[model samples]
Target chain A: MSSRNRIESVAHQTVQKSGLKNLSFRTLGAEVGVKSSSVHYHFPEKSDLGGALIQRYRQSLATTLAEIDDASPNAYDAIKLFSKLFTQECSEGKICFAGMLAAEVEFLNESNREGLQAIFNMYHTWLLDQLNQAGDELKIDLPTPTVAHLLLASLEGALLIDRAHPTNDRLSSVNILIDSWFGKIN
Target chain B: MSSRNRIESVAHQTVQKSGLKNLSFRTLGAEVGVKSSSVHYHFPEKSDLGGALIQRYRQSLATTLAEIDDASPNAYDAIKLFSKLFTQECSEGKICFAGMLAAEVEFLNESNREGLQAIFNMYHTWLLDQLNQAGDELKIDLPTPTVAHLLLASLEGALLIDRAHPTNDRLSSVNILIDSWFGKIN
Candidate 1:
């Protein structure tokens, strides 16, 4: 990896493990085998680094969602595939990076905050589209926006709870929720 | 409030506003009108303060839940009251204290981590009892534990997302979930 990618990689891992608050240039320096100044050379300000991190993360998530779209045959399978991303993160003993950033939104700089918002907007829009497409063929009881909000919130919340207690039941809960929603669909 | 109480109060607000990561002795001291050393005097270590904050928060939550039980007539009402507590916090532009702490759990010391765990346990147990009682009299499609987990996770996750975007629809989404669960109950 290049220096910038190396920095982003370590920063992502740190944020996932401990949260945005625990992330610092000094720690990144120690982990990346560079001095703090060298870390600064790549990104002068923490917010700049934060902005870059979220921008990269958003691109990666968009790519993953597009792949799921291409691979899944139906809306239900698409939703399941999306949820597995969060489940996979929890199974590795980390909260979703976006969820972690969401918790620290107030602490983030303007650029970083906007980046986080864009990521959520992307998720909400994508989920909304899936629900709408499914609702056309199936009977969806709640409004698409509400269901989209619920899915995002529930999955993110489950990851937080499961990480704290570690019952390994988040994926099951996600599955049950999806099944329940489908039962409502028609 | 006593100095200790005052310190805990400020720390709680800081954690809710920014996150546990941005909270510090200096900030607490500045907010509380004391020196950093004075803040240290109240709690020798940062973890000590974290433990005390969660302990105080847990006590407040316990009292609130008891009052909700005393005031609410049925499962649905009790659930609404519980959700209102979270809504009230969001209205004040804050995340639930426990939810904020959960995001930074990996950075916390053992005592603080256990304290956070205990808070979640209290919530789960309380919600589980309410769900089981309601399930006995009505038709609850999902298992009591699963429903309890869903309620807790959704509420917490919604708070985090709502804070990031400020759509003012978290309460609505929460209501829809509760109503859907109740719809299942019949």
Candidate 2:
């Protein structure tokens, strides 16, 4: 991988584990086996690093949502596929990059803050479209926007709950949310 | 209020607004009209203030749960009562103190970490008990603990999504989750 890509990868994991605020150029250097000056050379400003993290994650999520659209027959499967994204991260003891930024929104730089907002907007819009497409056929009572927001919000919350509280079944919250939507999957 | 209690109150709001990691004695002093050392004198360490916040919040939640028990004839109403605790905070653009700490858990001192765990434990146990009592009576299909975790985690996440995304209908997620449980409240 290129040095720039490697630095971004490490930053993603660190932000997921700790948060964006604690991420430093020197630490990125040590983690990626480059000099701090080299890390700086690629991204001079910390906000630049933060913006890069959000922008990349937003693109990746968009790609995955499109892939799910191609694969899922209906909203139920679409949601289940989407949820795998979060459940996968929670199992690894990390929140997703968007969620990490959401949790740390107050500490964000202006550019990073705008990037975070754009990511959520993109996510909300895509999920709403997926749910709206399935709305008429399904017997779901809630509006598409409401369901979209609830799923997005709760899944994000599930990350914090799993890490802080941790159930005997860590995915209890995730499973129950799916069950709420379309009956039990397992 | 006692000078020490005043400091805790201001610190609590500050932590809710930003995060526990950003809650400094200096800031608390400025907010409360005291010297930084005076803030320290009241709570010698930052962790002490955090522990105090959790301990106080735990007691208040316990009291609120008792009040909910007395006022709520069933789990549906009890859940609503519990949700109000979060909604009230979200309207202020602040996540709850426990949630703020949970997000910043990696930066916390050991004492504060345990305090957070106990608070979540107490909340989970109370929520579970409330749901279990109304289980057979209500038409809800999910298990007691599952429902409890779903409500708690989603409500916590609603705070983040609301703050980060700022939906046109901020409470849509909260309303829809309740609607899923017991149909539309209004």
Query: Against the unseen true structure, what C-alpha lDDT does each candidate score?
Result: 0.81, 0.77
Tell the DockQ for candidate 1.
0.59
Give one digit per residue, the lDDT tens place, for model 2 in A62-162. Answer: 89889988899988788788888656755555776787787778888778888888888887888888878875544557777887787777777777877
Model 2, B81-138: lDDT tens digits are 7787657755565776787788878788878888898988888899889777875555
Q: After superposition, how far is residue A91 of candidate 2 from its true place, in Å?
A: 4.2
lDDT of 1 by residue, A69-184 (tens): 99988888899889887577555668888888888776688888888989999998999888888955444477788888888898888888778766756546767878767774
What docking tier does model 1 reach? medium
Q: Residue A97 in candidate 2 has what lDDT? A: 74
User: How do the predictions measure up, each by TM-score?
Assistant: 0.93, 0.91
DockQ of each: 0.59, 0.57
Q: What CA root-mean-square deviation does each model show from the true structure? A: 2.4, 2.4
Error of 1 at B156 (Å): 0.6
